[model samples]
Target: MPPGHVADRLAALVAERESQIVLGLDPDPARLWPDAGGDPDPAVAVLAHCRAVIDAVAPAVVAVKPQVACFERLGAPGWAALAATVEHARAQGLFVLADGKRGDIDVTATAYAHGFFDAGGLNADALTVNPYMGLDTLRSFAAVARPAGGGLFALVRTSNPGAADLMDEPLARGGTVWERVAELVAELGDEHRGPESGLADVGAVLGATQPEHLARARELLPHAIFLLPGVGAQGGRVEDLAPAFAPGRAAGLVTASRSIVRAHEQSGGAPAAAARAEAERLRETAWALG
Candidate 1:
């Protein structure tokens, strides 16, 4: 039999695990494991660090989100590292969400869609996509990912302080642009809803920092998964995100990057131990809200 659809598959995983925590692997060259030390090739150091993080945090997380920019900056080798990271995450039986935020139109977008396909080295359960250009630009991405049991997370309201400058600007049509984008995402997701899951494959990239908007966003995209970023290091409290689970606990994926991986610096313990502890704390806290 064929694999289950991506939307239903993700929902099942979340339900089975009883956890919605997504681990963010954003390895900085400056903060790599002490032994990753002194390497001229940043990719080498990054790869070593990522594998270790995956090993350390696997048990506590339901998924792994590898930052594409961090690896892409290292050029070809960085690409190699990202591919390896995705493979390792899958091997550990965790879902992989490629946090690349890719956006384009026509042929260019098609090429990008191919990159995230399961047949490629960068195969991921889902990919973070940008819908700034237009909702139409996202068509190709959704087209490719959906059929392959993969999905896309289109940015709606981002976590960065600067996001308001563009995403929050009011449009003549009414409300902020992000609100309009949310509507589009809802439609896209609905079009591809899983018959068994009652969820959509086109998820949204929402920020945990703006939890207040969660209710409204939910009103618009009831079926799409909301990838809530900015928790922990970004000062987004998990308590404020209950609305994201309005659809169900499995509907929201709370993401944390520097917070878990670098917890040892502030909490004081072995890096791996601190990271695991922090991840468990987050998982427990989030699971309680619903």
Candidate 2:
């Protein structure tokens, strides 16, 4: 535990920022500026790209979702880039969400918690967790995050195309697997809810691609902040995400990466200019709905 509840912390930031757009930081070395770099180590270029993206979109975003796998793929250097990125994003007054989707039992889970919490050095405001291992796994994470004012967004329903194979499968008990996962997240949110924000430290990662699920997921976990990914390039319209804002203006978060960062592809302008413009566009669109 660090100090306050992450749910409330996020709510305050959202209100102040007046933007629910979460900038997704997925840096692909091969696609970086110049399309080719002489920086012997790709991670170096990756770091530069990440920083530029942050600088470009900070004004229109409330947080940045750094795909952990991108940095982790570079081994030690990649990990260092991740830490640097988190630090830089924080310095810019932007919230950081570590999108590692880690899950395990006992020490492994505990260790993962440390990485997401301030002590482990990741210093992320919130982490995305995989709850398939069961509630016990989530409990371990929540225990470490709660007192720190950090938060967790357990994977209740993901945005991947194949997610329905498991998440939408029918269970003997009733409803789909995702529905059950929603129930667990809702319970966790209720239990760890912050009185001030009327929100839970636990959150959910439901796909923006599947707008139908938003209403149901919100119904299940009213206080849990919904991190709806797969917007922008994935064809998820911002206008269809109204239900996610039912809990309050801060309840739903719409995330975009390539669409904003790669806007130059469509606009034929400088990377920074295109990114900032796209981010601004998204901000106004989502803010209006809120």
Candidate 3:
């Protein structure tokens, strides 16, 4: 399917679900599938763990954001597993957000666009991209994304502590660099607005870890959806992300991966069962907030 078609479907899913929770699939090798046995192929174990987690949480969330690095580290097998995960998510009626954070010159950016958005490739409904190269770079990728109906979540304010170094720097024209990124998110998103949801195709990733930024980000991109990461294991509070939904409760998407997947450790139960319980818990909490 084309990318724009995917975005439309995702918008409908978000509205129908009345919940914008996008569970992240950032699998940490050591922590995930520890019981898969130290075989020659750890990637297989990771794939199994990822698929199990997806099955456990698919009913509670609208989308899944897979951190590409986790797969990349495992080489070819990892990429294969990543592809399988994407297919699995789609089969379950969930959108897949390829969280690669790729950005570069126009030519390379276009390739990255193809790598994620192309029909024959991974076939993701949306992908997270880095916009540091400039508006033109994003514009290049957006050209491909807009037509396909795929969405891109530009990184604005990340959850990591080191983000303050660059994102917090004051700019001559206005607020911080992160604020400028928000402005770009709005401007670039002008073309992809969904008529029903009043949300633009271009979105922003505002870490749930930094709830305060939500207020500012919302002001900048009122019509854009905010992909809120850093929740659960990252210490992002659900209550703090309320501003992301000022336009509507569906405006903010709460994402969690490790917190739910590793929940078995605390529950002292089967991994799949514990994971499902954690996902349901997060779903209930996020819905209540919505």
Candidate 4:
């Protein structure tokens, strides 16, 4: 890997932390930590909840995936909160993957990239992008991310049931839409492959809910890191995701939102303590796969 490539940085962090969990921060204003609700402003409450969650789980995870919509709904205050959340995660030594799933063409794509990768913006370590518009859209994101030592995780086969509507469609050319998308991800990622880690700056969002597709996805994206979501609350098991770690421990990042944050609801304990325990459990399980 290049000295300062994003993939190299990610791999280094994974080894240092001895974990591959990516804490998903999809904060719902109506459902924050009990103490956070004391704040009148929803955005402030959300930020407090995020900080508490990070503080609890930072030691067990290598990164945080912040769902942008969760913060965007509150307008300016929410955006400010999102920025603060990213900064706080960084302060805790966790990578920030801004989950906007943004897609566009030309200058618009460049603008979105800037919002996530440039100075004074979120300055995320990576961003989730929608590749439905085609590879050019990804190119725009890479154009910005590469220079900033950032990365991009393109939505290949998402965890949502609705994804089957488009992603699973049999192409007339004799492959599935997602299979074709995987090919594109491989094609683009090859250009920026990390030498030491054998990972690419460009990666794939392969939902962990569908383990059957993982072997096939890995076949197509050998060098791309897989952001495997859907564990715990979404019913994805860590054992089924072993294929994603074939390249190395950092090759797959298991992201869990409600599974860790709302653990108190199921385990019945203090929110932070429950969340910390859940995150540690997930970290241990995923680390074993490597």
Candidate 5:
């Protein structure tokens, strides 16, 4: 990796924070905290809710993954809110991973990259991408992101049960579809491996709910960082993800959204306090595995 590669930066942050937990910010207008304040505009309220959550959990997490659709659904105001939320997370010293899952080829793919990695755009540290479109599409996104010290996390085996419909299908070439994608992830990330961290700027989004697939993913993409989602509300346990940390703690980032943000609902306390506690708990659990 170069001096300021995204993988290096990410590993540095993980070490500094002593945590690999990524706070997932998928705020919903209807689900805003009771004390998220009395903003009349839904977009503004959503931003407040996100900021509050970030403030509460920032100390325990190294990054935040904001689901783009949550903000995009509200139109222009929502877009602005998303930008503001990203800024706020950065202000709190957290890496921002824009969860857009964008995919395309040629100019369209480049456009998505700019929208997330450029100075005038979200300028996120990383973005989730869909690799179904093939390597050329990934190369296009990386062409833009890598130079900017940003990274891409390609979707691999996801947490959804329906993922089995495609990802688990046996290929005529003698491997599952997701396994092939993992090989591509490894191939594309090969040249961008970070020297200090030994992690690639290109990473994989491996759902934590599917712990069984982790060892295989590691075998194929040894140098890639793994973004493990589906924890908390998605029924994934941090204890089951031991294999993902084999490459190092920063190699596996465990993302939890509802479990952290909506923690008060189950624990019975102020939203911020509950969120902070839950995030800390996750941080400790994941850090121990490392």
Candidate 6:
């Protein structure tokens, strides 16, 4: 799975699915579904919730991004549920991204890559990566992701307000730390290009909640894909995502998590029904904006 091979698979999947959003599955035990047993095993409850959300939203989105911490906390049982959920998503023709944000040097990074991108994996189609470790640390992950036709969304400017403490700090080399991260995204994407749109395989995670950074990030990584998180409950407006689509409709992926999955709480309707409606609403709004 070289860069070209994986890029092709991703592009084709997105095209066929007619979606760019990757719904994140981050189940919190304290917020278990209403029907969940009082003494319900946290892992079992999470697995059920994930499946319900996937079943509800799969038709509207192309992929699902599961946060590893949510599952890791449940230990082996949690991992098993994660693998099962991933299999279900694929069975429904949806791509999966393990949102672990894993990063380290050499072999450590390489092993992490194998865990997420390998064929025998829980069958993830991509994973979020932390580029703070330097471009070299990403080599092993890239090696697996590129060839398998999987992908990585390197963190650049996260949505959390506290990110300014570091990500927005000025660097001695010039510009801010995030600017350097943007440069790295552009550099890694220098090779792979989309067959039709000319976009690249490498991408950056630029939170949609921080619209101000979108324009600059797009400029820096002109050819790289952009994964825009923080929409819906996070206060990111779909209308503010213009810069992300500058490269074209397929350029940026608008991801939402709790907002879509927990819509039932707001609507006072059946969880599955509410979740489906919410995902469709976001999909419609985002598609129009893009």
TM-score of 6: 0.94
Which segments of candidate 4 are over 4 A away from where they belong?
Answer: 1-3
User: Residue 235 in candidate 3 has what lDDT?
Assistant: 91
- Candidate 5 lDDT by residue in tens digits, 258-284: 999999999998999999999999999
Q: Which residue runs of candidate 2 sit more than 4 Å off their true CA positions?
A: 1-3, 35-38
**Mind giving the per-residue lDDT tens digits that candidate 6 earns over 217-253?**
8889898778888998889988799888887666788
lDDT by residue for model 4 over 1-290, one digit each (tens)? 12388998999999999999999999998899997656989999999999999999999999999999999999999999999999899899888899999999968999999999987788899999999999999999999999988899999999988999999999999889999999999999999987778799999999999999999999999999999999998899998999999999999999999999999999998999999999999999999889
Better of 3 and 5 by TM-score: 5
The alpha-carbon deviation from the true structure for residue 66 of candidate 2, after best TM-score superposition, in angstroms, is: 0.4
**lDDT of each structure?**
0.87, 0.87, 0.82, 0.93, 0.93, 0.82
TM-score of each: 0.96, 0.96, 0.94, 0.98, 0.98, 0.94
Off by over 4 Å in 6: 1-4, 35-39
Minimum summed lDDT over a 10-residue window in model 4 is located at: 1-10
lDDT (Cα) of model 2 = 0.87
Task: Kindly provide the TM-score of model 4 when superposed on the true structure, using C-alpha atoms.
Answer: 0.98
Which lDDT value does model 2 have at 58? 95
Prediction 2 TM-score vs. true: 0.96
Clash pairs, model 6 backbone: 1-147, 2-147, 6-149
Score candidate 6 by lDDT: 0.82
Tens digit of lDDT per residue, candidate 2, span 184-252? 888877897878889888899999899999988888888889999999888898999999999887889
As for candidate 4, its clashing pairs are 1-195, 1-196
